[model samples]
Target chain A: MSSFEAGAAGFVLGAACGAAGAAALALANRRRLGRFLSFAAHEINTPLTAVNMTILNFISGALGPVEKTQEPWLKMLREQAERLALIVGDLRDFIHLRLRDGLSMHSESVDLTPVLEAAVESVSWGFSQAGVAVRTRVDAGLPKVLADADRLQRVFVDILYHCRKFRDSGGIDVAAEAGLDGRIRVAFAYAGVKSSARESALALDLYYPARVRKDQLLTATGLGLGVLRLFLREQGGDLSVSNQPDGRSVITADLSAAGGGR
Target chain B: MAAKILIVDDEPAIAENLQAILSAKGYETSCAFDGSEAVAKARHEKPDLILLDVMLPKMDGFDVCRLLKSDPHGAKLKILMTTGLDRMGDVEKAFQCGASDYLIKPFGSVKLLQKVEKLLSGA
Candidate 1:
């Protein structure tokens, strides 16, 4: 072989090796950042929880008797605490969704009735505060689903919380029933707003705000519909958004029935 | 005699706060700062209930619960696992490890006492 050919071959090998090393280092750094973020999110949440619990104790008079005049201040602090927790939760979900691929889930045979009811109750105060009436109906003896109950509850909570921000709409109707195709479908139909195809697509995008019209603005929840879809998809389920001509925007989530109903 | 409770958390403030709350409710309470300490105290103290946190230094709450539950006497001890994360896997692990109940963190005193009372009453 010619000397020039040998030197060229060596140079090519060296360049390929250098590129591979750089790629590996970059991947390692990404993982390290993900771990740090996960750790930071948990550490922040722990102390915040302690603070909130202390606040609750004070408000409930577990520590001592409360004065009537101090009620308003306590109420304000409690509200702020809840807001902070929600923000932190959103951050944690974002970290999992973006940095870590997706959140981990353990699927099992889950009865969705109690989970749906709990999600509604968790966000009931928001609905009332916004003067929005939210109704939920889980058909009797609906087939049990294969899902992570806690993750499903989080999905429902995120949807309900985001829907309540549509205060200008008439109200929300939530219903869950067993489909003949061996799926459990839960639909959230938002009334009194005409949603376009573009609007529906925007709602499920990674970070876009759901805008039905120039005058109507829906506040963004950091745990976006796209993240929910990814979560559902990972568990062999699916999520969809559709618009009806009669001025209803429907968001439907479907989960597989335990044992596939066979 | 008041029912004794053991509170385990790596965070000093959380363990101290839980101890204070339980003590105020007329239950005798003790605190352990880590997983090893939690297991040792549960055996030595033999409290009626142990509020175990999932994340700890030496060992995690799940391992601690599993080890204690394996023992003849520890099988009778009621363990209520607590965690900051709402991960579904953690919930499954807690119950699988023989936890009596599980609570997510930042829980109010009302919820805490309710679970504590229910477990103590074996209802």
Candidate 2:
């Protein structure tokens, strides 16, 4: 072969080799980032867990300091600790969902009734202390949802928590009904101090789960509204919000019911 | 004469917090700072239950659990894997090695005591 043709052939081979090398490096970086996130999340959890538990002892009256002066401060500490703990948990789940394949991580046939009941149980003391009643009407024998029971409980608990936080001297009505479109819809309806964000909250049908882009993940962190929706979608459901006819904000999540491995 | 519990964790804050709470509940509580320390304490102490952390220095929680489970004294001991690694995969691994129960981090007083009570009651 001529010198010119030989040089051209060598250049083509070198370009291919460089492209392969770059691809390998990108893959390695992705794996390293995942490892770092996992380690960070694990480390953060230890101290956070200790602080949260200390607060839990107080909240449960284990400390025996029922002084009237410390009531407000104790409540605030509990709420903040709960919030931080939730964020760490949500971050861990997000990391796993990002690093792993998808819903296959925790997908299973889950009964929604017990999950909601547990969520309600978790926040029962808070609701009672705030004089906010909670009522639930989960239909019997409702088709199970193919989702992670833990995350599903979190969605319900987190939703109820917000309602209880922003409550306005009334109660919460949680009703679950089997939807006609191969789904199970659970609603958390409450009447709270109305705000300007009411409309925007309903209009926030932004992260649809199916289209969870990488940039979207970066933007959505902690236990934000977007994160809640992402968790639902990650389990093959969609979250929507609508104002009740009685002026209450109703946050509804429709998850695909577990039917024949759906 | 309450049951004894070994709190195994690398973090002093977590270990002490748990130790305080368990002691307050009338259970005899001991502390171990790492996986190896945990094994040594379990072997010598022969506690009724152990609140074992997943991550530790020198040796990790899983290895400690595996080691204890194989020991004759720890054969029937109740091991509760307590850690921040709340993922199902990790939980399953602990269970595979014979964990009595799994409790995630940041647990409340009620939850922790309830689990401890149940475990001691042989549930």
* Predicted model with the maximum lDDT: 1
Tens-digit lDDT track for model 2 on A161-261?
76776566689999999876667889988886543454435334445333454433112223545568888988888787666667786779888888842
> What count of clashes does model 1 give?
0
True contacts kept of each: 0.59, 0.67
- Candidate 1 lDDT tens digits, B44-72: 99999999999899999999999999988
Clashes of each: 0, 0
Chain B TM-scores of the candidates: 0.96, 0.94
Looking at model 1, the pairs that clash are none
Model 1, position B6, has a per-residue lDDT of: 92
DockQ (model 1, Cα): 0.54
